[model samples]
Target: MEKSEFDLIKSYFAPLASGYEEAFDLLNDAALISEKPQASTVVTMDTLIAGVHFLMSDPAGDIARKCLRVNLSDLAAMGAAAFGYSLSMAYNSQIDVGWVKEFTTALGEDQQRFSCHLIGGDTVVTPGPLTITITCFGSVARHQCLKRNTAEVGEDVWVSGDLGDSAAGLKLLNKELDVSDAEARAQLIHRYRVPEPRCDLGIELLQNAISRTAMDVSDGLLADLGHIARASNIAVELYEDKIPRSAAFSALMSSSPDLGLALAVTGGDDYEIVFTSDPAQEQAIQELSRKLSLKLSKIGKVVSGHGVRLICRNGKTFLPTKAGWTHF
Candidate 1:
């Protein structure tokens, strides 16, 4: 039997709205979000296209999770608690009911893990490759949202978890690099496929008044920090050794030190949070890190100037030929 678009939604997507009464079982054209007193809504959207954002050969479940997680990373950057998301998918002949079942199963798992619900969305057939777009909605205290321009001079720059694993993972996946260690190889590939968003850290930073300036490192760390520097009209002095790296990343770097450092600093797809806070909050930040069991590394500081500078261990400055990934 040929399945229609409505059948696709009813079978795979409608069940994702189990807890969200306002979603109306994905039958309505739109979903309603009631106002929460003294709170502001945060909305973020991201689109992923086949062969561009992800490989077509990847597992359908992973592809679905990555699509949702990237948008969740955006909400985390703003210190927002995700409530719900609206998903849109354009599928080609390559996708079938079985593939969609796996995809929606992943979304259902993530919805439970993140405490968010699926609201509504549209599905359409396209002759081109499959594409997915997700719009995530979250909430934060009124007028207390984090901003890139709110960084103050002399504040400490911090990042959650290790870096460069994702880029290394991509290299391995593309066969540009090979790892002797099977465990390390698998870890890197996993990081590339599924990025962990620092939602709790973002909320702690904003709610506790620990920091006001933050942005997730979707691009290279250097490039994203450059954003904070440019936005705040300040300069950043980053210590190359201070940038955190996992054991797998370090092993890869041990084989190629220069390339490792460059990739770690400039490689994109690291969804970790890069935030700034006053030095006085160091103890509090450390406590938060321990409480959350997430590594928070203090990598640099904001100074009065323009642009970002990477300082090497030898007290010399190191500059990359290319700053980061760019669409253009």
Candidate 2:
């Protein structure tokens, strides 16, 4: 005899039901609870398809973590604090109890890391690839939240950490790039498998008002910068030499400069913060970073033009054959 679906759901979730209920306490009012009462809520949603966003062969645990992290990255872009989230998972009959257990375990870990409670969600059987849709909710002080359209002329543009790690990591995963060093290979693979959203840096930037506007680098730096440019009605002059790259990236560039930089531009999934600040905030940024031990680097400036231009180290401009990635 086969077990009924209700029996299966109960057996799988029974042991963890109490913890799940605790997490869902925030959802009682159709709104996420916030510690800062005066802050306005910021909500975002992201969906991941197994084949498009991850390998069908990928571990359910990793897929679960990445699902939540990607949503959190959007909250970080708004400089919001992660408070809670809900999820919907669609799995085929091919999935097993073991897979659900692993997926929930990863979700639990991410819930802890992001300081977000897992509110409530639904699980259903589907016919195709695994699909996970996560809705994340966060909060930001009314005056502190950053917007893409808030960029101003003469502000210094900065990004946290290096860009293109995920892009290179994906290349390595696809076997398009060869890494001779075992350690380097491990680093790149980790970047691809697990991206760290800059929550701490984002909150710090908001609290100190160090930036006028901010966004996350997800769909490639140039693509994301284009969003700010379009929204703010201003152009950006990005110094290609200033775009941060990992040590491995520099090694690759030494052999093929053009290809390496192209990967940096067209690649995606960096998740670092891209923000702008005027010179008046320079000393404040410096002081805050020193106190917090966070690394921030200036990469460009807002200009009077319309689109993005890559300026060389010697100040020559080069236009990209293609600006960045597009999802259709």
Best by TM-score: 1
Can you give the lDDT of residue 47 in candidate 2? 93
**Model 1: per-residue Cα lDDT over 1-328, one tens digit each:** 1688989888889999979999999999999988589998899999999988888988998898899999988988999999999999999889988999999999999899988999998898888989999999999998678889988888999999998999999889999999999999999998888888788888888899888999998888888988988889999999988999998899877978878887887887899999999999999999999999999999999999987788988888876555443421
Q: For residues 1-328, could you state the per-residue lDDT of candidate 2 as single tens digits?
A: 1444456545543333335455433334243253566778788999999778777777888888788898898898888998877777788875787788787788777777777766656667788888989898888886568789988889989888778777777778788888888787778767777778888777878877887688888888888888999999998888888888889767755687777776676577888889999878888887766875766788889998788777987778767665453521
lDDT of 2: 0.77
Instruction: Give Cα distance to truth, residue 87, candidate 2, Å.
Output: 0.5
Candidate 2 Cα misplacement greater than 4 A, ranges: 1-37, 322-328
lDDT of each: 0.89, 0.77
Scored by lDDT, the top model is 1
Error of 1 at 189 (Å): 0.2
The C-alpha TM-scores of every prediction are 0.97, 0.89
Predicted structure 1: lDDT = 0.89
Q: Residue 94's C-alpha lDDT in candidate 2?
A: 59
The weakest ten consecutive residues by lDDT in model 2 span 23-32
